[model samples]
Target: MGAAEATDVESEYSSLVDFEGPDDPSHPFNWSLPRRVWTTAVVAVLNLIGTAASSIFETGNGQFMKEFGISHEVAVLGTSLFLAGYILGFLTFGPLSERFGRKWPLLCGLAVSSLFDLMPALGHSLPAILIGRFFGGLFGVAPVAVFGGVLSDCWPTAQRGIAMALTVSLVFSGPTWGPVFGGFIMGSSALDWRWNMWVVIIAGLSATALCVVVFPETYPPAILRRKARRLRKKTGDESIRTASDKEGLSLQEITRVYLIRPFWLFTTQPILALLTLYQSFVYGVLFLFYQTYPVAFGTNRGWATSLEYLPLLAIIVGIFVAAIGIVIHNQLYFRHHCHTPDGVFIPESRLPPMIVGGILVPIGMFWFAWTATPAVAWASPICASVVIGAGMYLLFIQGFNYIVDCYTTMANSAMGVNGSMRSIFGTVFPLFATQMVHALGVARTTTILGALSAALVPVPICFWYWGDRIRAWSSAKVATF
Candidate 1:
């Protein structure tokens, strides 16, 4: 009789502990429009600050080389090591967000990263600067690793595309913006490379402070756990608990969730593997441009140091234009699929823009490859960068949305896997970027890049037509809707 009574109590408690209803005001998805918009913007800003730290130093590479008496190759380590940190942070933070929640992990990461940002700003030796830069990147990537999940938690699938576009544009543009600001500082007679580090430190700390005040916890499980704890105190019933409370936090569970699962999904999921590799290629090319841009605009065209970084703005312009297009398209076409009764839209619905983006990338690369010479008008290559930027943005935003849609619950792990590869490529590509351009010449170097991008142009198109079938073969739990 007692066992039966306990079973009845447990059943009643489970229902009580869930969201009051789908419209529960405490739920992130049910938050007010203004709150959601502000949250999304704040999250985007955090990502921007994190990624911007990686390349701000590049603008002052010349000064850094002179100050430290290091070779150009050694100086490049500052940027490469920062990217390497992305891999570590992504691997660690993604699962941490899954287990713990988004807000605290994100907050802790930003705070620590900001503290480390001081390494580059005040380090008297090259080793200190490099170590600081690496750790800064390692912790800073928390936003990059987990913001996708935050946005996922806040926005429903239908409205997510535009929000994602706005966020990703800022995220991708961060590296370019770093150089833009750093250039003016480096060009100033009073400022030097350290000022760039200071700029990152200020931005990072400011972002951390802002998030602490405004950011709300978004992860569903984490939020529910908190609610369960509150109910337990209010009712004095220890049985008031969430499903997650029953799950073990053992070492084996941690290892499986953090390490084994991500690797398994990365290897076994074909759609994930192919898209990840394509995105990695695109990412590597973007970093490669950091090295090549100086050579093309400053060295070959004899542009002023302060002005050379200005052309990279063309990428930002393209990113802005592409973002608007994505938002508009999502409103018109993609939103319909998301409105389905089951709320299970085909993930392939996200691929059309990616197809157009794929075509644009190679065209822009080839156009810039041949026209980047001094004799050619500078505006020609700048215009080409616009195309490249637009293409890259489309690929980035759509690919990310597709991954999230395909693997609904496991999106964080999938993204972490994808981010790790992208970071690896971003890290290694620049180490030899200068050598590649010098040996192959600008035309040949860019031509090779163009060729690589062109080869993958079919990726989105193939996925568009046959993605449903491809997704069918996945062993992991894919979204059925």
Candidate 2:
């Protein structure tokens, strides 16, 4: 080759490796479509496995109570501890991901969580199982915090609605299917509760393996840092540097961004604060149903065996079917009206499905509570669960998408804060589920939750109307609509 041609080629290569600005092609936003989709799928699978493991043990709570000679409240701790661990995990892992990068932390967490999943299978004691479950959740937070960040890194704001909808749908669907499968496994005389843990452990292992294989490094700063390191190594010159090294926060500064900033946003932003509360309450109610279903179907309604309660699968199917309409709407809005650089139309468009979901939630709860009697037939309550599940997904989809639209650059941090609060609710709600039903009766207990649901309907209305003003008032960083 001629010297001039070689010089020109060198200039092009140098420009590609510069990585000095927002326009860098190495950024995750510029990754090829196949790579982006594969990364998203891996993250989604990790979330699904983590969530599935959280509630799978609940299906065998009866056997756990029998074997451990513990009260219902104590046996419930197996589920509660998992959520508590997740709460704590979110606080720690979210910031940690910002520091060390997404891949290592997620891989380490999945490894630790998988190990914890196996521990309960080996230990016979209740306390051991509880401890193991708690640690499992703690490690499992990696997927929850990192997945949204991964999505934000790859997908544009307009396209993210459908991607996030799929992710949340998988997360919600995981716990529902876990018990269905767990019931079948535990119902077999040949296997016991240990099989539940084993099944989850196997699934976790499979997901972890898939993640390690298919998931590439998506975080842009981390990629550039690695490139800088390689350049320094090859040239033996100390001047090589990444864009992040020049402009990014120090470890202490990043810590403040990850830890303190979320609290600031939580306290100062009315929209974030209110949405957090509404989402937490809905999440709590959903977790309550996890415990309530076993009691309502198995004990109160005279289901003779483990298999008899399997009709709860209908609720899951119904939820998926109803969620499809919301997904379709999200896709349609994005295709037509949601095209905006500043992300205004997306948030406004989320309100319609959210309003419909809010109405369905309370109506379904009332229906289930009133018709739970054996004489009414089990289908009555199952149908109610369908409505509740559908409503829950609707609220979940809107809340999540709204947050993503509002906080474009800091979406992961916003999700981390919201996730911590939701986990706290998940941890607390199941403990009182049985007592609430017994003291107030299912009809009254659920009516109270339904009333709460009804009250929250106005939340979306307020957001739909005054959302622009609220964002304008916020001190925390958010997109201007």
Most accurate candidate by lDDT:
1
In terms of TM-score, the best-performing candidate is 1
Instruction: State the TM-score for model 1.
Output: 0.93
Task: After superposing candidate 1 on the true structure, give the runs of residues whose Cα lies further than 4 Å from its correct spot.
Answer: 1-16, 231-239, 337-344, 475-481
Question: Which regions of candidate 2 fall more than 4 Å away from where they truly are?
Answer: 1-27, 30-32, 247-255, 338-346, 475-481
lDDT (Cα, tens digit) per residue for candidate 1, span 17-82 = 678789999899999999999989988888888888888888888888999899999999999999
Assess every candidate by TM-score. 0.93, 0.88
Count residue pairs with overlapping backbones in model 1. 1
lDDT for each residue of candidate 2 in 1-481, tens digit (9 for 90 to 100) = 8999988755544423455576667888777788887788878878878887888888888888898889999988988899999887987787777767888888789778989987788887767888999999999777877777777778876577677777777777777777778878877889988899898788877777766876788777788788978988998766666555645577788767777777777877787789888989988887787766766777777674565447667666656766688678866664677546764454566677887888889999899988877779877888888888888888888888887777766666777889899999999998999899888876788889999899999998888898877776663344321
Model 2 Cα shift for residue 315 (angstroms)? 3.7
Model 1 deviation from the true structure expressed as Cα RMSD, one decimal place: 3.0
